[model samples]
Target: MTKLTKRDFIAGATATGAAICMPAIARAQAIVLRWADGQAMNHPSPQSAVKAGLEIKEKTGGRIDIQTFPAGQLGSSRDMVESVASGALTMVTEGAALLGQFVPQISIIEAPYIWRDPAHMTRALKSPLMDELNKVLGEKRGMRVIGVTYYGIRHLTSGSRAINSVEDMKGFKLRVPEVDTFRAMAEAWGAKPTPLNFSELYLALSQGAVDGQENPLPTIQSAKLAEVQKYLVLTGHIITPRLVIVNDAAWSKLTEADRAIVRSAIETASAWQDAEIVSQENSLADTLGKAGMTVLKPDLESFRKPVLATLPAKFESKWGKGLWDRIQGL
Candidate 1:
């Protein structure tokens, strides 16, 4: 080896110093986004966000880093969305019902019996119609919805009596979210709708404060509702979808290529989450049955007729006339 001169030695030292500092510079320049959600860490949606965050970092070559906060770590779902809109938070996964307060038409996604099934729901949400709604949401609230994931279909659970028909719902005190659609759904079935905080539901059910409640099977399992509720009636009343929303300003800051990478990562994660939710929903009935709940597949048509007849008329004005039919056509 040739002996190095002072100039050569200085040059070598400068290159070594630059290489050592490169990673620290990249870390400092990386765009870190906080993605928050209300679901527990074990829940599919939150897990999906975690998966997307990893993929985003990998695909963006560490230029973008997503940090996920699950189970209301940041705040309640509504609060998180508000934070996103105000730019306090970078992103949030929220239900259409909560986002509906921004665009009333969007809330119809949670209307009872509107979607024929999950496939239909997925198609409608991905369709051009939703693009129009998304535009409206962005314009009205400065929030942009980038991805949608399947949250399980909502069903009824009873502590005392199995809901076999609409008649069976008469005088039934059903716990429902304070949302008007849910309250209207319970009333259409002839049940007395009790608006209560979801945090209080388990104790309420255990003590007979409410006769029945409705939620997706995965939620039922995750919340350990099988312990408090004795009967699972497959009314399949509502199909809920979670929206991956970001502040428009935050989304606009990314380069187009980075935006594409982030979107692709989220799409991949959502597909994985959808499959997991469907798998869990398919098995949950038996799982809950084994846990001492009687699982009943009630005549869904009986449940469907009343909801369609009453709900569409009640909601179509706000959701846009024919929006219900358009979604059903999906």
Candidate 2:
């Protein structure tokens, strides 16, 4: 047997304590990220986010965790985006038009009539154009695009008017998100755009503050707008693209392997979300009709022609020359 000095006794005690504390320290230091979005908790958009976060944790062997705050829980779309930009929030999934305040040209993704349909918009999202825009966004705004999901086709709903043609929109009070592109679209359609926070839209419609509003069918269903709005006109004016953005600071902290895992998980979630949204959109018209809203399929060409003439020209300067053409070509 070997005799132990006081120094040896203290060293053994210290070693045992560290052995017990190390695992707790590692667990506490796990990379936890917060993701915020405006969609409701039950909506496919946020559900997909939760799914992706789970995948990322599993793939990373518990190194990273993403916590999703949906349904404007963190704040409005603009507020959440601002939080991500300032590194106060880790990530956000929001409309490209809202993000346009940071990278102006990205708004083109949500411009009315820019896409023929959801499938066309999906192709454009996968095109090199998105790469160019993503680079610009990261460089200029310190946000990186990790995934793009197809937000459903936007349509008009009303309480007092049934919008069947462009003339019907003239002087109509239409509620729009506080995005310049949405306002521009409303103007081109001949409606008086009323910029309002989305959370306030239901009340705005119910109180007759705005005569009508536009959003995807899924949003109408999730937000229970059918209870307030009387009509659903399927103008399909815009096939909006939803972007998943990570603050550059948060992204930079991950290793290349972990980054790949994160990106892959997000891409998987986005694909699933796209499919789910399209599926929901397919059936929501009937669902809304059952809920007491009159569904209308108007002369879509009447809506398309005016927007094509005005919007492209209006945004081309800020969106860069020929970018619209390239997107169309895609």
Candidate 3:
């Protein structure tokens, strides 16, 4: 990753194309795909996406080409999701929690303390329940999930103050991504959920537009949020996930051989990304602590109990009755 050469990703696989990964994607016959994400260029999400793009190129013999846009170059997460939905963009990286907007059942996984650990997330998502949910979204919203990548256990960061209890979060404005599940999760703990785009989070925190925000450590590090935030509370509230998706139109356009190539490459890239994130999370706290942030591992049960209690009444209607129990059984 440190020494990326032109032939590795920029040069198009088997075709004698220019030394640009996205160069001349408008060729008459090649299926050019746009892979967009809101994470920073240095983040593992984009890095893994680049690797997947190269693999797709190689496996498809240059028949499929992918170009990546990082750091909200396309737009906010909601905007990118819509773009992909409308076929304005071929693909985009989005969180499953946000996908709840279209397919509400998937949001059940995003509820607080749902995944016992990162591994549980992998198993639960790859389980039949998720398969059925994916099928629903595919039939209803044209969403074709290519990969499920691990985002680390989420924690809280604030410019001032430490959250030691649910009482401490009372009335505190927490900046959440433009996703409803987070808003409900934050509200369940009695925090004021302030929705903001991730791309604008650092500035929002630095300028006091929001009191605090929650995200995985790799994101906090890659965004240099330590410069703005002071306290890192390891509540480990939610083990989040990001979905790499292509529109159904794009999927239908692909031949069976091309679809297989893309799916295999995506699975390979997702495994690498998930492993890398686990390694990063293992040590990111110390790195953020060294950056002058106070890191505290509060009593997680205090945070977990309140949020978990709300699911049956809050989400059961949409996610279906006993969905949480079924997920846990998985």
Candidate 4:
């Protein structure tokens, strides 16, 4: 007949616990996971990744603790990948294009126009082919892919002129990701591709080592490239997705419950990241324009032809016809 208030319930519960139980409970549940990335903490991708980690801790009742290191404080992407492989670091969120070096199958996703839309890409990710690719990485390469997050539609920024067509790219010295697919894409577009570390891109642009670079508008804005670059072309050449990866050694050490928790958390986080990128893409050009950069709307069809023409041959050779067909079917 007695009604218990919330405070009464807590007091009653605490009264049943031994004095030593609380500390033991805390000690048994505390888990610390380290996450490293090559972007600033405030950057959307890293921020989203950290938000996911925090959500995991909250949902798990503080049983999981995540320590985030951003802005290359831990190391470069290559170093982070190596650290994750060796179990020196717990996890990292990096561009899938970078994974092409370790798993060539990843290069197929880097091919231009691989997906007609973000929804298409998301669906393709859930396909059995993608599952097989992830399995291979975990079973053979010592890395476990948790989920994929979008970077956004990539565009061209330059110090010289507006890129209106493939012909406009001629003589442009463009900084590209240190990946063969990107290099090949830039070459196909008629630009001279220069491979540079993302960290070195700012200086490369400032010193005129490269006349331009391609990236999402948010990246161009976040890195303050507008201050040095004069033109912005909406090429949407590639829509890059970043992979959430953990070292197989680290992942294998976790209990199945913990692994499931980690996987679920990554999926939730990737969704948040993808939505954030879409929102950013919607507003990025306006923001860049306000920053004094000349924004040009180019004839995307002309650019698409060259990129698509090169894809079939390049992807078929690298990933084979079956996998490429499977992706196309998606």
Q: Write the per-residue lDDT of candidate 3 for residues 1-330, one digit (tens) a residue.
A: 233223442333334333234445454456788788889888899888899999999888887888888887777788788878877678888888888888888877777788888778888888887778879889888877878889788999988988888888899999997777788889988999999989889889999989999999999999999999999999888899899988988789899888888889888988899899999999999999999999988878888888878855787888888888888887
TM-score of each: 0.86, 0.90, 0.90, 0.87
lDDT of 4 at 4: 34
Q: Evaluate residue 123 in candidate 2 and report its C-alpha lDDT on the 0 to 100 scale.
A: 84
Error in Å for residue 182 of model 2: 1.4
Clashes of each: 0, 0, 0, 0
Overall lDDT per candidate, in order of appearance: 0.84, 0.86, 0.84, 0.79
Candidate 1, RMSD to the unseen true structure: 10.6
lDDT of 1 by residue, 1-330 (tens): 123333553464366446656777554666867787776677888889989999999988888988787766664556677778887678999888877767898888878777778888888887898899899999999998899999999999999897788889999999987577888888888999998756568899999999989989988988789989989999887889889999999899899999999999999999999999999998989999999999998888888888778888998788999988888787
Q: Better model by TM-score, 1 or 3?
A: 3
In the predicted model 2, the residue pairs found to clash are none
lDDT of 4 by residue, 1-330 (tens): 123333553464355334436676555646667787776655787887778888888878887877777776565678778778876677888887788788878767766778788778878877786788888778767997887888888999989777888898987898998888888888888889999878788889999999999988778877889989989899888877778888887678778988888788878877887787788889989888898889999998988898778866876766776776778787
Best by lDDT: 2
Q: Residue 289 CA error for candidate 3 (Å)?
A: 0.3
- Stretches of candidate 4 off by over 4 Å are 1-29
Of the candidates numbered 2 and 4, which has the greater TM-score value? 2
RMSD of each: 10.6, 10.1, 5.7, 9.7
How close to the true structure is residue 315 of candidate 1, measured as C-alpha lDDT? Answer: 81
The true-structure Cα RMSD of candidate 4 reads 9.7
